[model samples]
Each structure stands twice: as C-alpha cells, then as structure tokens.
Target: MKSLDLSLRQKRILHIMQHNDTYITSAALAAKLNVSSRTIRNDVVKINEELAPYNARILSLKSRGYGFESEDPKLIESLNQIETAFFSKENRARYLAFKLCFAEEPQNLYDLEDEMYISHTTLDHALRDIASQFSDHTPYIRLIRQKETVRFEDDEMKKRLVLVEMLRKSWNYHARRNAYYDDNFIEPKVLDFIIDLVSSNLNKYNILLEDPSIVFLNLMIAVMYYRIRDGHILPYEPPIPKADTSVYYACQDILNTLTDHLHCYIHPEELDRLYLFITANRLLDQTTLTRETAKDYFGPNTRLIAEHFLTMIQNYFRLDFSDDDDFYITLLQYIRTLQRRSDIYNEQYTSDFVKNDLRIELIIAHLFQPLALQYLGKTLTETQLIYLAYCLCGTLENFVHNHPGDKLNTVICCQMNMPFLFAMKRRLESDFGNYLNITALLPVNIKNSFDFTDTDLILTTVQKPITRNPATDTLYMSINMTEDDLARLEHLILQRTIRKIYTASPSPHDLFINAFRHEKTGHGDPYSIFRDMAADFINAGFVTSDFLNDIIRHEENSTYAICPGVAYIYSLIPAEKSAMSILTLDHRITWNTHKIRVFIMTCFTLEDMPITFRLANLFYDEAYDLPKIKMEENPDVLTRYYLSFIDEPLTP
Candidate 1:
C-alpha cells in the first residue's frame, strides 16, 4: 500500500481511535482536537482515504463519533510508520520548552496556537503545564508569562539549564531521546565542534575532566557563542564566585582557549563566574585530592558551624565519627553547597520545627531543623535535608552499630517442596537481613513430628493447631509473599502482636442500651445514620451535643474506607470530649456512597494520627472479616482487639 499524508490533527484522531476499540463521539474528538464537531466530520473523510490504502476504515456511529476496525495486521504496522504530529503530552512539553528557550522575541498566543495546530485553550494549558513542570524538574531556567505573552529568558540560567540537561542525558542510559531534537532543524555540529575544542583545551592544560564535565563546558561555550553571535551579550561585570585561586585560574585558562577557537571577544568576569561554577560542581578528577586538601581553603566560620552541627547530631544519635576525616571533609562540602543553594533559592532560616511526619524526608527535616537557624542562617528545605541524611546513612552505616547482632529463631512450616521452601526462606533473610534466623523448615509429611515450642515465631501457608508456647505466635501467609506481607512480617518480627485477632478486653454492652437498632437505612445515607448514632452517644452521656459538629465535619470530608469493608472517621475534640465510638452496620451500609460494613470513630487530638493510621492497616488485613465481630453484643471487643497494635512514634 502507498503512503497517505494526513494533517497532525487527523493523525491524532486516527491514533486515538486505533488504540481504543470503543466508539468515540465526534463531540469528544472535537474537544480533544480543539475544533468543532463539523470540523471533526470533515477530517474523518480525509482520514478514511488515508486508511483506504491500508484496507482499514473508521467505523462512524450515529451519536458516537468514530472507531477503527481492520482485519489486516500489516495495516496497523504500516500506520505507525507514518510521521505525523502524533506527539504525546511529554512531547508537547519538550516542543514548547524548545520554542520558548530559543525564541529571541516574546511569542504571542495566536502565533503559538497556529504553530502547534492547537485551540487557544489547549495552547494556554500547554504553557501552564510547561511552567509548572519545569519549576519542579528544571529549576535553573523557567517559563515566564506576562498578559498572554510568553518566553524563557533567564540567560545565565539558560546556559546552566542546558549544561545540566546535557549532563543528565549523558547519565540517563535508558532515557527517551527528545522528540524536538528530531523535529526541529537545528545545527548541532557547531555544538559538537565547540565541545571538542573545550575538551581538547582541558586535556592540554592537564585538567582531568569527566566525560559529562567536558560535555557541560562544551555546551556552555556554545551557549555563549550562540547568544553573543546574535547580539545577546552578558554584561562584562559578572559576580565573582567564592573559590580558591587554583579553580579561578583553571576556569580562565579554559575560557581563553574557547575564545581562541571561536575568535570571540570573551569578557574577563565571565571566566571568573564559570570558574566559580566548576569549583561549586566539585568534579575534580584527581584521585589524590583529599577532603582536607579542599577544607584547608574553607572559611573559619563555615568550619566552626559545621563542627557544631556534627556535635549536635552525634549527641542526639549517640554517634561518634569525629575521627573519620572523610566525614568532616564531606560535611564541609555540604555546608558550602548548601550556602550557594540557599542563596539561589532565597530560603531564610526560621525557629519553627516540624511535627512528626511519616516520610523519611520529614524525619530528616525535623532532626536537623534546629541547627539550620543557629548555624546556617537559613531554613533547610526537605531536598537539602534529604541529601544530608543520605550522606550520613551511607558514611556511618557499617561501623556505627557494630556492638552485637541479635538474631531471633524463626520457624517456617511450609508444606511446599524443599526447593521452594529454601527460595522463600532466602527471600525473607534478604529482606529482613540478620534480624531473623530460620532455625527450622518443616514439610507437610513431618508436621506432627516437629516441636515448635522453642521457636519465637512460626510462619505457614495455612493456620494449623500446633502445640507451642503461648508467646510463640503463628502467622498464616500465602505461598507467594507480597510487599504488604513483608511489611506486616517486619513489624511482626519486632512487635509480634500486629495480627492478634482479639486480645480479650472489656466488652462495651452498656454504652448502647435498647437504642442499638439493627435497622438499615436506604442507600446507607450518612446524615441519617450519623444523626441516630449522635443521639445514642448524647443520651448515654458519652459525648455532649457539640459532638454532632465533629460528626458532620468527619462526614463532609468523605472519609475513605481504610480497609475493604471498613470506614474510619475522626475529628479533634477537647480532652474532656475525646472518646472512641464503634458502629458496625447490621447490613452493609453506604457512607459517601461506598459500602461500609464496619465504622470506627475516635475524637482525639493530633497526637492520635498514628493510632488512626494503625487501625486502618489492622482492618485491611486479608484474614479479617467484618461480619464476624458483633459490635452490638460486644462493643468493647473492638477496643480490646486494637490494644495490641498501638505503636508509638519513634520520635515521641
């Protein structure tokens, strides 16, 4: 079949229909293509001719727009070969970025709209997405807009951004090639030639640079040429970077060589600024260069402040790595980079501390937060804290906690074959490290012959009545352990009571008297059920009338069911008003239109978020069944059941 040339819009419509078998409405296609339904109809006819060569036709429905169906396999394969503007969301982002970056003049709305073949609405959205996307990923250069006029015009930042991107691409072995690089007819041999010249000069000066470093210097030089050649020269007076004389000299030598190659009038301060960058980058390839070699040139104040932070961390964590020279050297380097980053970001130090947060980032932030204001003179971002924490973990991981290893004796009573049992055991050891010892693996044939009384824990495929000590609990697991199972097991290894069904606590029969009705509401209306529950709590003196406000607040947020058949809702209350409530629907009732078999509510302060979080996890366990626990008969049963799973936050 011969090829057919289709417009970008038509190809997109065809691509959408080709991938999806269901009929797509013309109105739907029109909205996506940013055109009227009539235009979509007109495009469909031309698309049909394009497909006719491949013996495929688009199925048009009366109310529905169109679908694609083809008997020939070669038809779809040949369609992929057709080069059209079938750009993905990411491709559009790159295209917009390229247009904005290289544009000498501010681009208007209509111009961008025509260039992209997009509706004004689509172009505006693309611009906004590009700005937001780059703010997170590419902080050096950003997309700017003023009253619908747009361009990317941070020049020095532009050079930095291009260099950063090139370095990133070199490291990202599996990263997708940029679509614009293929579409835009831009010259790169000039880029390559300038890079080669810079690389050659650095080698000639006996400066050992990494491949990415050479690429960066090469790209930066090209950026200077392209901008200057087009009459976009940076001011001769550039801010000098804080650096030693050696780095300043090396930076100048490289720039001098670049100027000679291009026959360009290079500014002197530009050389110093570039030198400052190399010094900040810290990509010195000399193997013999020790941390002290760099530290000897650092300011006295930076060293003193870093030493204070090291002392505080050491005292808090009960760590002693003061003897390690690498630790001191790396700490000094972080201090320097942090200052530069803080200056660039304009992050000011504050006395505020972080609350207990779950993510590793928040934890690290909370730990070093106090030191930031006193020493660094600025608040540290989570990103900065993250880098510090990772470095600390890496350096002190091996020798810090080498006192003695305590291994728990664990037994795996799997009915599977020996090969399968060993594989499962190895996987456990790999995940848990030296925390557990697989002392025994009993097969199904010898189940009765084995004694598990001395074991700490027994894991099996199914629940079995094994004679063991009361302390030695049995955990039933699936043949294939998932990530959730591993997490539960890890917690179980420490707590050993994570899956305890019922710990046998006081039953709450009096909290709800004859008012506890088994009535099921229509569609499980939340307002109706909550009204009745609030009455029961008020009448019983468990809570005051203001409890209704808390209930409404919880319901309005549309609390999601933590487990498959469980929904938990809670709000902060006065210490006196703080109480726990349980309501198990007689029949499955809908809360927020989602079926709820079990409802647990707790009115407590912020200190209890961990308790609520743990309760949700407990209910989500697979072995759990909602109907089995009769809340009316035993209200306090749920209370007793959860006592074993309460874990205080490590910090608190």
Candidate 2:
C-alpha cells in the first residue's frame, strides 16, 4: 500500500515528466511510440493508478496536455530509482505531435518509421489510428493525415477555441484539492511580451477588458503563440461585414507584433476571431458595437431579440439597464456572437457552482425563456439564460450599490384596517425616510399576483408567500410593530446602511493558521497578545510592523468586545495589505479591565470593512458561547463551528 509498481512505459512517462515541465500531449506521445494516442492515454490511466499510493497523479491541462503533480520529494526521486529503456508513450507521443504539428514538409511513412523507431507495420497502424481520430474533420481543416505526412488546414476561430480550452480546464482526480501543476505552458518571456503587447494596444484603443477577460486573452495569446510556433498555422480571412474598426485594427496591431515575435504567418480570419474575442469580452468608450451597425455585423433578427430582452428586464426589474450604454453595447455584441456560435456549434457554458445556480437566477430563467421563444423562436439554454441573468444581476447591483442616492421602490402589503394600515405606512416612511419609495399599497384582500415583481423589498404583515415573485426578498412584521422589525426592514431596503456590516469574509479558521495566523496561550496582556498575532501577519506579508503600533493605539482608545471573553479589533488599510489574525487564550486576559479569552483582530481596506462588522454581529449573537469556543481543543470541531457563522447569506 505504501509503494507502487509501475510498468516500463509508465516509468518512462514519469521520467519524462520528472525531467521536463511542459505538458506532453497524447497525440505527441502516440506518434513517438509507434502506437495510437489512445494506447498512450490508456497507459497514462494505469500510471495514475500506480501513483495513487504516492499522493501523485497525471494532470492534463486542455491545450497544455499532460504533466505530473506530486508534493513528496521522495516519490519524485523514486522516478530515477525505476529502471527504464527510455521508451515512454509520453516521449513517443511528444515526438509525433512535434513532427505532425510543426514539420514544414509533408510527413512520409518511411521517414516516420525511422524517426519513431517503429516497424513499417506499426507506423501504418499508428497513422490509421491518427487519421481515424480526425475522420469528422471538415475536409481541409486543422490536422488531416494524407498518404504520408500530416497536413494542417487553417481555421483560426475553431483552432483558438479548441486551443484556449485545452490550456484552461484540467482533468482533476481530486476536485477538492488545490493541486494545480504550474507548468509554464509557454516560455515566460514570450507570454509576458504577448500580454503586454495586447494590453497596451487595447488600452490605446480605449477598450476596457474585465479581469476574467484579461486572463482569458492572455491564455489565448499563450495558446496561439504555442500553436503557431509548433507550425499549426490557422490562416484567417475577414468576413464581408466586420466589427468595430477600432477593435479590429487594435487586434491587428497586437497580432502583427505577436506574429513577428512568434515568427509565423497568420491569416486575416485569425485576426477577425481575435477581434470577435475582444468585442465580446471588452467595453469601448466610442460605442463601437452599437445597435446602429447591426446590419453589417449581427444576424438579421439579433437587434429585435436584443431589444425585447432588454425590454423584459426593464419591465420585470423596474430598472432601466438599457440606459447604461455599455450594458447594451456589451450584451448586444455578446448576443450576436452567441447567435453565430449556436448556428455553427452547440457548445454550452456549464458550471455546477452555487453562485451560478442561484434560486433568483432560476426565476429570471423562467421569465426569460418565454421571451426568447417569442423573439428567437427558441428557448435559451440554462447556461445562456444564466449568463443573461448575470448581466442583469450586475446591472441591478450597479443601480443598488453604485447609485445609492436613488430611492428604492418597495411594496407595502398589510391586512389591517385603513387607520392601522395608514399608521404602519407612516411608521415605514418615518423609519426608512427618503431611502424608500412605497410604490404600491396592496390590501390583504386585493392581493393577486403583484407581490413579487420589479421591486426591492416586499413588506407584508403576514407570513404569506408570493407565488411569482422569486427574486425579491420579503420582510414579515407582526400586527404590533417594534424597533427590531423597523431596523430589519430598513436593512433590506438600504444596503449601504449596513455598508460596514458584511455577512462574512475569509472564514475564522482560515484567518488562523491558513490566511493569517492564530495562537493559543495563557500569556501576556492585550498589547502583547496583539503584538504576537501581528508578527505572523507581517511575516505572511498581510500587514506591516506599523499595524502592531496601530492596533495598540486603537485598542488603547476603544473596545471591540460586545460579549464576554471575546474582543475583536479592526481598522482600514490598503486592500492588498488587509489581513486578519485570531488568538485564543486558555484563561481570560484583561484588556482595559475587560477580560478576554478570545481576540480576533482585522486590518482591511475601506471596501472590506463590512466583513469586520459582520463578524462582530456573529460574535455578539453568540455572546454566551465565546468561552466554549476558547476551550474547544479539537481544531477540526472548532473550525467547523466558526465556518457555520461565515456561511450566513447576504440579501439577494
């Protein structure tokens, strides 16, 4: 159980991985071994099975191919211990892939047989297997094995998607483990130059790419350069009607520089695909992807569909995202791309994440499907609808968070008589002030279907559920109103009021030992307690020495404890330098006459101050339990208890 027995081929693969850092693709391995890539891939499976005992496994990044991830130096050192004849499936396949992908001249069977160290029969079988893998290829696209050598046909867009995806997703044997093998897919200098060139050109054009898009664009650059260097030329030609000239020209400039660096010939179609990638992902100041240019760029019915989609969101949400020019520009261009992609390929953006699978998004999907069916004559896929939902969510958040001065619309629902209803209405206006706009006053008897749609908060005196309104949260109040009810309702209406109060940040245990640092001792007063914790944060590069001084100064003036045996301290710092530390004492230590057995200190930027208050809220709510947490010696059980507090949901 402690050791694994590996085959000669497996040992060879391990040896290659041990010597090199780049991914070795199965195609490359197959060509070298004089066997099918399929055989090499199968052998890799057995190799991984053996590596299981050593806490190591074969990892594959889509475009990058396959490599190994192992932490144990002894396990890695064992690679040299295993005897091998230098014939690995990975080595052979790598050889074949290089030959087929990069060979300037056509590949001949005789030359391949000699180069691959295989018999004529084996070479013939390998070629047949390789050819069969690409049987579904459109005649002259990408790789097609002819009589002798492998021929590559240029199809830039498809090539980019395939290549980029290869570099992005990885085969994870253990999803829960953060076991990423960082094989610099391409040379660092080349990748850095490509990123800088693309970034500068886009900035020159006044085009803005979000962080995710920036990462994707870099990935694309890496893949494109990698492929072109390997001799997979995807010649691209521009279609008749094109996108924003600025974006097209910007991409052209970037691509030209990239191609020169890569020393490869690129087609216009590749540039066009790059333009499309930028157009779909980035925003421009000049409104380059406007609705006015629909005829030249988008499909015939795209404008109409986009119009209806925005209209539905505006009406349903009672907000106008269409007014946000960039929203329309970004979404309209993306929809056009979606239409084109659907026509050619049926690939979907799939994820099982809770954020993507939000209950509110489900409601939005229900409302959006009918509109898509009416406008496009078909329902959108869950992925497509979820994408639209994200756009809407962003727009809504911008309106809610960014435009806090704007009055939020709310519907007050109650079953009381006229006088009591009027009294409650007055109470709401008094409590919430100008922050809330009571859009509709629905009587208990008049209730039908207006409860759930296009509003911020629903205030109902009863606990009745609104059937159709899925996105908006409802606040229920008893017949007799109290300050707590008013405060909770106000919290729902104006999110900024709780700007300092966050639901959670890095989990409590994550702060201790993982992200920040933790200590458990019955030594020192408050100042010494803080100094010890601050040292860890400073060492972890989460804070500076000045933080220790600040903590002493702040705690000297104020108190962070609301409950017994616990004191939490925090202040605003730069975002990147923001960090937290947790300390638990065996006995209560006095802080300005306040005894504390547990102390959690936080330093964050202004933006992250909310998490501080949120944590404070949790501790205050758990007033009687601080001593219990301090005494809990089992790290696992204590960590789980702390994590439960961090999981509290924010208002949707």
Question: Cα lDDT of all candidates, in order?
Answer: 0.54, 0.57
Query: Relative to the unseen true structure, what is the C-alpha lDDT of residue 348 in candidate 1, on a scale of 0 to 100?
Result: 16
What lDDT tens digits, residue by residue, belong to model 2 across residues 237-325?
44735658888889889888877777777667667667777777654344455556645665657767667777765444344566665
**Positional deviation of 168 in candidate 1, in angstroms?**
5.2
Q: Which segments of candidate 2 are over 4 A away from where they belong? A: 1-160, 169-179, 235-245, 259-276, 279-282, 286-303, 310-357, 370-379, 394-652
Screening candidate 1 with a backbone cut-off below 3 angstroms (N, C-alpha, C), the clashing residue pairs are 25-65, 26-65, 349-378, 349-379, 508-636
Give lDDT tens digits, candidate 1, residues 424-522: 899988876445668888886676788766676777876676544665656777898975578677656534321221121211122122224333333
Q: How far is candidate 1 from the true structure (C-alpha RMSD, Å)?
A: 13.0
Model 1 weakest lDDT span, ten residues long = 346-355
Q: Using Cα atoms with residue i matched to residue i, what is each candidate's TM-score against the true structure?
A: 0.51, 0.37
Question: Model 1, stretches more than 4 Å misplaced?
Answer: 1-93, 130-148, 151-188, 191-218, 238-253, 260-265, 283-335, 342-362, 365-433, 437-652
